[model samples]
Target: MKNEINIIIITPELSKEGGGGIAIYTQILAKELSLDFEVERVVTLKERAVVNRVRVLFLSIVKVFYLLNRKKRKIAHIHTAHDSSFFRKSIFVRLCKIFKTPVILHLHSPSFALSFKKKSEKQQENIRKVFKLADKVIVLSKREKEWYLDNIEKRPPLVVYNGMNDLISSSDKVSERRNTVLFLGQLGHRKGTYDLIKAFKKVLENYSDAKLTLAGDGEVDECQKLVKSLQMDNSVEFLGWIGLEKKRELLNSSKIFVLPSHQEAFPLTILEAMSTRLPIISTFVGGIPEAIENNISGLLINAGDIEALSRNILKLLNNTLLCDKIGEFARERYLTHFKLTQTTENIKKIYTELL
Candidate 1:
């Protein structure tokens, strides 16, 4: 037990500054994997200043090579998304292969299929070279697995839902929640922040006491201008890039959580909302429907439909019984299916089998 085999998790960065979703997932997954294996995490990218970026990459390369040289049973569990992440990790994947270490390429990129379709033939050849070197490939959702099955010339990618520590708490249930809808993701058209803002502006018409708290940062100035232009400056508050403690506070106070993304493989924020027992109202895109059941765990609306988004928000805000019921079901589902315990167990099996 003390001398368990090592597993190296390669990612852009282990910290939050690298970006959300994958950064958060890699950190949480690495922490969980550490308990079962001698996990050593390496970052191929960093949130460094422009001048120091190349220096940082060089140091990381040196460190990774040193770690890979260690004489121990090891598996390179590379958590790769599409685009430059795959490019950056090519050397790591090659090194692990040269070392004869089992490689697990975990795909988190949402638009992998779309991206691959657009790639030039030569570019496609290079990408396929990386895929051929992997002992096994893992993806975040069934849709992603199917995407790889159609593209990659290998056995189907295994589906492994990204997991996190239980967000349930003793004082979890808020005795008196506010009439606020929370949107936690990057502020952009891709995440449907504009649609959320439009729907939220309408939400204020019926429930004037309602507040729409938009957390996370990206094009804040534009979103703020949109809110101001719509005369929703007073109702909408953009709390840019909050910490875990602050996130919990916001989740606790809010009645409903939404993520109207145009694209996503699986959203960690929804899982967090589910864990916090918030009635979710998100767009049915990518793997969201798999995590949320329409009128069951939470309500699901079509993407870009502000009318439906607004209707769903008002539906939950007005109906306390339904909100409580859906929130309860969401939390139960997280405990049963999306918890770290279940995900880590599956990861352990993949590691054990891949060897």
Candidate 2:
């Protein structure tokens, strides 16, 4: 069966090192599918330099053309975000259509609706045309699927929440975790990093010993400036762009995980925190509400609400029993819905249907 079906996963960069959620998603999907199918990964954008990236993209197009020309039962699984990522993957979708091969457009963008609304009418139509070309469209959340159904195209997209392997062990104990709050992802305005910093400052008014750790790359200088301005330099630590092992260590040691993003389709970091049995405090945006029940598995606050963010953080920190309960419930939800095996199986069913 592995030799009979060929699955081609298209992404900007396939490496786990310094890759965003989309890259990580592609890597996991490709690895799992390879166990049962002949998997090929086509990296369309790898180089950091603009000229090199453009050259690589062109080469990827040629490579896709050549691969589809071969005699095989193949499916092109293209992972894309908004704006340039969408346009780049649309080329592959068109090429797959030309070869009469099934293509799946897997969207991982949180602000895709906003991006689409910013485009001109003709450009919006072009975007719709590209979406229509694909044999199937997969979204990260049901909310996203509905948005596409009402705005992008009438065909409803399949929802596939991002999943992760469980990261907690029996030896891991809540008593051993520190009073540390962890935020993992790009450090920019969209992610509400500055808001989190301000909220953390407020949190320090009560629990002065509480620490905030910001990991991942983006606007580090700006975020540092904000931290300094808020007099949180001593309390807030920024570790730019960490690897998987470091992320796991942070998840295990941190008492809480918070991501107050202005927008998100579905964040894999939330699932990672859940898998590690860490109480989460995130915004009520995108598919987050689907994953977290308010005051149950985790706490949810509106985006950019610094006061609410601070209050929620304190609510969990002030009560250890409540924090442990939320963390345990989060882990339960992860095991029931967002485990890596379950996600891979759902994706495999889509592939089978398309085939």
Candidate 3:
């Protein structure tokens, strides 16, 4: 085995300050990879930091050229979207082929073919061509990996579930709890913020003492309006955006954790909640089933089923025994599979094997 492996991870959009799942995943994974490899991150701030198109294009070109000429024997691992066409085939992909080094495209989203097919046939064909260029593809969920293997021939992907760092200790577990529900993540339709609000309305019917706390920000006006229109001001609380300390505080104090997202590859918040011994009630989408067992570790309801969502929320709140069991089971699951130590070891092995 080589003494060290040099790897470069390039992403179009990377924010060190924003509250995005991809950013957090990249941060943690990068830190872990650094323990065993010489990992350098090259990020392009597309619209957030750059205003001039020429400057943005020039910066991307410089970054690529720097990676291409930096060393001869290092791997250029790129984080790219599936449909990032000519840019991928001619720029990043072509560079790897030129250097005679393997390229790993770690994908976070679903196939562009599937998403583009909903838009137009021509768009789908364009996306299909882009998929044919990747040397090795990485997906976060089994569903996503299977989708690629089933649709695309000769370019199968490796499935690796996103991992979260363990932030809680044995002493962090609390015996006392209040009647509070925590929802962390974007306040948008696909995240199921609206669905959670609707379910919270029904949940409040029986559990009048319960309060709902909403964290993270997106489409703020719409979510705020929905809460006001439902006359749930007294029961609902919104904290626009919070840091690590406040997030942990909310998770620790809350009685139940809920995430009703319609689409997700994997959620870092779910693992965070489980790490703190919080019972999760989430929608059955993406790799959620891999984390939560229906009615075992937690409850999993349909994406848009408000009635079932409300029912489960109420069930967990009313029955303290069920809540304790689920929360305990969730924490155990986190310790058993999602802990960062094992995740880092597995990832380190993959890097060494590639080297």
Residue-level lDDT of model 1, residues 1-355, one tens digit each, is 5436888888776335546677788888888878768888887777646556567767777887888899888889887877767887787889888888899988887777788889999998899889889988888888777767777775877888877676655444533588888999889998999999998888898999999999988879999999999999889999988888788888878889999989888999999889888899987888888899889998988889999999999988888888888989999889888998799999999988977
- Expressed as tens digits, the lDDT of each residue in 79-181 for candidate 3 is 6554442244336666666677667777765334456457566755555555566566777777777777776555767777667876664444433688899
- Relative to the true structure, candidate 1 reaches a TM of 0.95
Of candidate 1, the 10-residue stretch with the lowest lDDT total is: 167-176
Tens digits of per-residue lDDT for model 2, 26-68: 7887888788988988899886788978999999998888889
Instruction: Please give the range of 10 consecutive residues that has the lowest summed lDDT in model 2.
Output: 167-176
The TM-score, computed over Cα atoms with residue i paired to residue i, of candidate 2 is 0.97
Q: How many backbone clashes does candidate 3 have?
A: 0
TM-score of each: 0.95, 0.97, 0.89
Give the candidate number with the greatest lDDT.
2
lDDT of each: 0.84, 0.89, 0.75
Candidate 2: residue 80 lDDT (0-100)? 93
Clashing pairs in 1: none
Off by over 4 Å in 3: 1-3, 12-16, 46-57, 81-90, 110-113, 119-126, 169-175
